[model samples]
Target: MTIQWFPGHMTKARRQIEDKLKLIDVVIELLDARIPLSSRNPMVDEILKGKPRLVLLNKNDLADPKATAEWVQYFADQGLPAFPIDAATGTNVKEILPRVKQLWAHKIEAMLRKGINPRAIRALIVGIPNVGKSTLINQLAGKKIAATGDKPGVTKGQQWIKVGTEMDLLDTPGILWPKFEDQMVGMRLAATGAIKEELLHLDEIALFVIKYMVQHYGAGIQERFGVQDLPDDMDNIQEMVKVMEAIGRKRGCIVSGGKVDLDKTSLIIIRDLRAGKMGRISLEKPF
Candidate 1:
């Protein structure tokens, strides 16, 4: 099945962001640390042209540290200020405002040069679904100003929150593009819980993730689920199933007739990875 999610309200959210962009001085874009390239909304570039932007890699605790550093440099090389932060633990979240100020330094200085003391800075914060945008806001405010959940689409509308005396932050609903051009991108988003779980089958995405872990993180896969060995081939479904069955047997997800409960096994794998029970991993690395 081709996995995609573009609800009607997302269209409204995009228009709302576009309308507010005119009054905003800076835009903070949140991306999933595990899938930075896949989690970025393509519409942001067209709507936010000529605006100062700080790309935040949220959920850094769940991703590879080396890959996160590379991604930070990747964005920096492209002239986009990016930082890795864990919204849940407030890790490196303290540096967010300073970077925002750093990116908009020229504009902030220009206001002073003209003898015009700027008012509160208006920043539009945008991200794809379930990227910890709401949690990050709460971390910044040191209080819960926005609703948050593990599932996507928890924040249904927009609200202006006073982050500090000199800045007002606008939290918008997470908006997804109309289509996913690459199928792997869809899989990564779904596996990372950025997309709703109901939209895709956990069994299939778990297999995809297993294949990746087999090739790139074999030791992690073995250690997490207590699988004795990694699968031999990515294209061979039987070999993949063998590894999954071993994981299921280790977790006691077996039926009365001695058959492995694939659904239960897949869900355990998915939830474990999502909760970072597996070792530090990144689905894709910058080439």
Candidate 2:
């Protein structure tokens, strides 16, 4: 099934960002390390219109280091400096301001040449929902200036937050495009909790997670859930269901008649994946 989510507030946010571009010196694009490409909004490049941008892969703590490293290099190859950071734990966050300054160094130097002291860098930070935009902003500001939540759409409005005297951040609400052109993108977002759970079919997301892990991270899944004899065919729906059921039984997700509660089991699988209980898993890799 195709997944689409475009709230009315997000439309307003897009327009507001355009109106405020005149004041922005640099754009910060935050992406989930596990699904960096998928978490990126397609409209970003067109909207920002070649503005200076620093791509930050947030939530790296829960993502596979190998894949994250590859993604960093991938962005670097494209001339966009990208790095992995854990906004929640403040890992690699200290480098943000330095990098922002580096991106706007030319502008800063121009002011110095005219005998004028440069002002704080005006940065516009944008990202898809639940990609840790709020958490990163709070970390940078060294306080809770932005609302933080695990679910998407926690920050509904744009707010200017001062990051000391070095930078001023414009935090915009996380936005998704009107429609996901690729169905896989929707599944990955839903599986990673970037999309609201209420808008998802949990079973489908659970299966997608299982199939991905089985293909690229079978050992971790087998060790995490103590399930063996994983199906060889990635397209075998029935075999995958058996594996999910086995995981549910192991996790004690049983209901009336001793049948596995698929819904609860799905939630458990997705939760474990997000919480890193299944190890440093990444739903996608740099292609």
Candidate 3:
């Protein structure tokens, strides 16, 4: 499976972000908690070099709490202040400012020493699409300043949003790399809705989700779909097919010919996973 999704607009977005980087004091990088590493745009480090950064593990509400913690610690070890946040619900939104300020303290001190009046910190909000950048920005601004759509590519250009009197934020379009060096990264992004659903093989992604759940979250699936026995091993296609058929039959995703509807069944499973119906799960956790 070769997965690569990079539209031309993302190129334009990256160029704009590079140009806008000099105007900001810090970069607040948002990442889907379920796929912190995979959802990260590879170009961020180069584009945001020398800028103090804050990483928000957005959608922590839907991710395994333990994994989220490990990821936070991992980022902290790398000199970043990373926190778990549910941006859609405004969880931990208030806590962002202090951490970012703390990161920018040295610059603030330098300004004070130079007899320069300190200016409000400006942070560029960035992340992969649908990873909650817009939602987080809206929460920070206390209004819907940035477009918050459930799908990717909602916010297209750059705009500065004032958050209170002391802070300014630049909301940029979420970006992914031109090509994924690892195919599994693309799969993870698709599974977490970071990439547009129409751009990938939803059925393959759904099967990957189902397989992962069966391995790490069987009981949760059993409760959500009322299937007491999901196949324990997904490596066997026949066994996996049986499990999908069972789910389709139970969920009433059947056609007039009395056959299981793969598309509807796939959507049902994927939706349940995204909506937290299958319990908190993390596809890739830091070791």
For candidate 1, give the lDDT of residue 185: 89
User: Global lDDT of each model?
Assistant: 0.81, 0.85, 0.80
Q: Tens digits of per-residue lDDT for model 1 on 1-287? A: 22244466657767767788877888888888999999887677876777899899989999999999999999989989898989999999878778887777787799999999877777877787678777887877788663543349675555667777767787553344522568898789878887666778889989988999898888888788878767566798999999989999999999999999999999988888888888878887886
How good is model 2 by TM-score? 0.89
Question: Which residue ranges in model 1 land beyond 4 Å of their true spot?
Answer: 1-10, 146-159, 171-181
Q: What tens-digit string does per-residue lDDT give for candidate 2 at 1-287?
A: 22355467657757767877877999888899999988887788888889999999999999999999999999999999999999999999989999999999999899999999999999977787688877888888788763544449775545677887899887553344522568999898888888766687999999999999999999988999999989999898999999999999999999999999999999999999989999998888987
Per-model TM-score, in order, reads 0.89, 0.89, 0.88
Estimate, for each residue in 1-287, the C-alpha lDDT of model 3 and write its tens digit.
22354466666777767778878888888888898889787777777876888899999999999999999999989987899999899988889888888988998899999999998899888876677766787788787663544449666555677777667887554344523568898788777776666787778888888888888888887888888777656798788777888889999999999999988998888888888888999998899
Q: Model 2, residue 186: displacement in angstroms?
A: 0.6
Q: What would the TM-score be for candidate 3 when compared with the true structure?
A: 0.88
What are the clashing pairs of model 3? none
Best by lDDT: 2
